[model samples]
Target: MSSAGRVPQGLRRVYLNVRPERLGVLIGEGGKTLRDLENRTQTIVSVDSLNSSVVIEAATPETPIEMVLRASDFIKAIDAGFSPERALRLLDEDMVLIIINLKEVIGDSQSHLYRVKARVIGEEGKVRTNIEQLTGTYISVYDDLVAIIGDYEGAYLAREAIEMLIQGREHSTVYRFLNKKVRELKRKRLTEYWKKDFSTKEVKS
Candidate 1:
């Protein structure tokens, strides 16, 4: 199936592809995971294991298209190596999945891609762990793709750090950048919260 894009608003169907190996993860033991997804999104998910294709259809006319898209993203995230628990975060309104194609970044050369993946992953997963901690994002370095799941700001920050590492930046440098950005993000959020709270009080008065 071709990559899914925004469709006209309404109950609709979407198709996504999953790797054959990861189908079990998507299905879960006894189909619990897939059922949970369908329940949460109010959609029906059908899997074709032979084709590694998934079809998601809105369960009712009242079902929102956004929910359908969310299901699609949830599957894509898991297919990209995110654990089911981590992928579930996409159900949240603020959480998102950001994937970086290593081939697009460096090249199609397997060795080159492997080297870049190693840099993002670091030894013993220290770098990936640090990035996740610093940006509050969950990252997966799977095959030739690096997937990030988090709020938009955190996910973008994590992506930036990974890109820096891919560009041969020192690990320490990437960490510093994340640290600075994360602090700024916190302050911005605090400022926005107060502004919103003040406006609410003003209207109440």
Candidate 2:
């Protein structure tokens, strides 16, 4: 069958597995998020509550291709540790960072890298927020790089703190002083994310 004719023959189905709880968030209040996605990508998105999977069906080959690409990007963002509710927050602003030379301290295992990155970002990003608040910067700890976004002064402070931590600074010391500085910065905060695009774009292009 021709591509156009085959489109209706189950040729445009994309499946996504999401957590049961997240399904509601993705669907949004009154199905706003789902409807937006469908309207934008020109694909019909249906959720299967029984299996917690999303099915995307396109009316045309072109639409399906675009839908798949966009859907994959969304899925990747979620799999990379973002909540569906907060996914859009990252779409416009870049909030990720990759720290180099991390392997030197934590070794190259995937699990170890994640553990170290978690340490850098902290619980619910509290640590990172402190760094940004103190330094007037936004920090994102990714696989192999620590990203810093903010004004010069804030970035400098954050960089220094990260360096100290990596050089074996005691967590207690880092936390105490870092918290103080962030508070100060918040009062005088005047910085921003210099590189405003997500880190993925940097690597891809």
Q: What is the TM-score of each candidate against the true structure?
A: 0.92, 0.44
Off by over 4 Å in 1: 1-11
Q: In model 2, which regions exceed 4 Å deviation?
A: 1-11, 75-86, 89-118, 123-205
**Residue-level lDDT tens digits of model 2 in 72-160:** 44543443344454444333323322234577766779886776677777788877777666665556564465656444555567777
- The C-alpha RMSD in Å for every predicted model, in order, reads 4.3, 11.3
lDDT of 1 by residue, 1-205 (tens): 4325434444388889898999999999999999999999989999999999999998876677778989999999988999999999999999989999888878889988888988888899998999999999999999778999999999998999998999999998888888889899999999999999999999999
Model 2 TM-score relative to the real fold? 0.44
For model 2, the run of ten residues with the poorest summed lDDT? 90-99
Candidate 2 clashes between residue pairs 3 or more apart in a chain or in different chains: 97-147, 98-145, 98-146, 99-144, 99-145, 99-146, 134-182, 135-154
Q: Which ten contiguous residues of candidate 1 have the minimum total lDDT?
A: 2-11
Per-candidate Cα lDDT values, in order, are 0.91, 0.61
